[model samples]
Target: MTRGYTGEVSPGTPADVRELGTLTISKLSVGPMDNNAYLLRCRATGEQVLIDAANEAPRLLELAGDAGLAAVVTTHRHMDHWVALEEVVATTGARSLVHADDADGLPIPSESLVEGDRVRVGDCELEVIHIVGHTPGSIALVHRDDAGGTHLFTGDSLFPGGVGNTDQDPVRFASLINDVEQKIFDRLPDETWFYPGHGGDSTLGAERPALPDWRARGW
Candidate 1:
């Protein structure tokens, strides 16, 4: 039942009770880095897709529960985010989904995704938003509701208070900030929910007012 997090908490274990309208979303905080793995299951169709699949394969598998896993979507080409990628995919026989730009680094075969592409989990459609900077192919999956509510799954792009780390690369940092501002902040409403790849949750409203300060910091 703990789906959208507005603050940080030591996530206990994998759970499948978080309901998002007709869909069910579950999370498992795995790996040494505490990477978060999420399972988005369509309650109507019993089909699901996983995000990250970082580590602790058994726990992640269990999170899949009875819902059929259709695919594994990697937010980016981060080592922490996909350390258990092969393990999860092999066991589930799920297709690996990665952005086309970051596909070269993955150890397994993956079908490349791009901006504006639609990924279906059961009958729910998730739109891919390409966010470059944290990693060239980093993407955010967005679920919009008929009532105008929105949920954004941002891997390492936009975080609770700032954009993902850029290794002090000014060019990369600038690009990331630009995309987060123009593509995300400028476009999405303040009420949109943001679930980062690591750590807890935050809303666009909570983080939006501080964008200027974050940009100036050049982190």
Candidate 2:
């Protein structure tokens, strides 16, 4: 189901999904930018993965609870994305993980991830894909569930109506758009659910129709 910035995806206690095997991806709105911080949980094993700890440290810590926070993954090293990372790691004692290209932004040491790198949390395995338009180290996490649906965690590379901005170099924006079209847009199934770092969740099917317009608009 598509979710917006309204209420939490699953309010109260966690809800279990048979196919996902206790997996939950909760979005936390943070900073003045409305950056998205995801809380991924493995229901069976109670293992968790926190993505982009931007802010709201107290709430994040409470959300993590006693689960074994396996890793803290960052899509890039932008200040808005990594600002609260140190605080989250300190509170949960979870190791931080980022692409080798973006590892310098983290407060602590981080492992370099690449396209084929697989991160396991409980029964779920997230495959890493590098789509470097927004930043040199931008990455997306793709997970194939037993229920036959694909979940894509696109940090800042691809969004609902646009792509990540090329703040450092305008030329890189073209490369970023090309990467999203070839690597992410074309590879995933039409039904794939896209969980972006900002805005609401949309499907590959929903976003596909707008690609040409986005490209024309130079997004």
Best by TM-score: 1
Model 1 per-residue lDDT tens digits across residues 76-121: 9988889888988888889999999999878798999999999998
Worst 10 residues of 2 by lDDT: 10-19
Which candidate number has the best lDDT?
A: 1
Backbone clashes (count) for model 2: 2
Q: Which stretches of candidate 2 lie over 4 Å from their true place?
A: 1-22, 168-170
Residue 178 of candidate 2: its Cα lDDT?
A: 90
Pairs with steric clashes in candidate 1: none
Q: What is the lDDT of residue 53 in candidate 2?
A: 81
Each model's lDDT comes to 0.85, 0.78
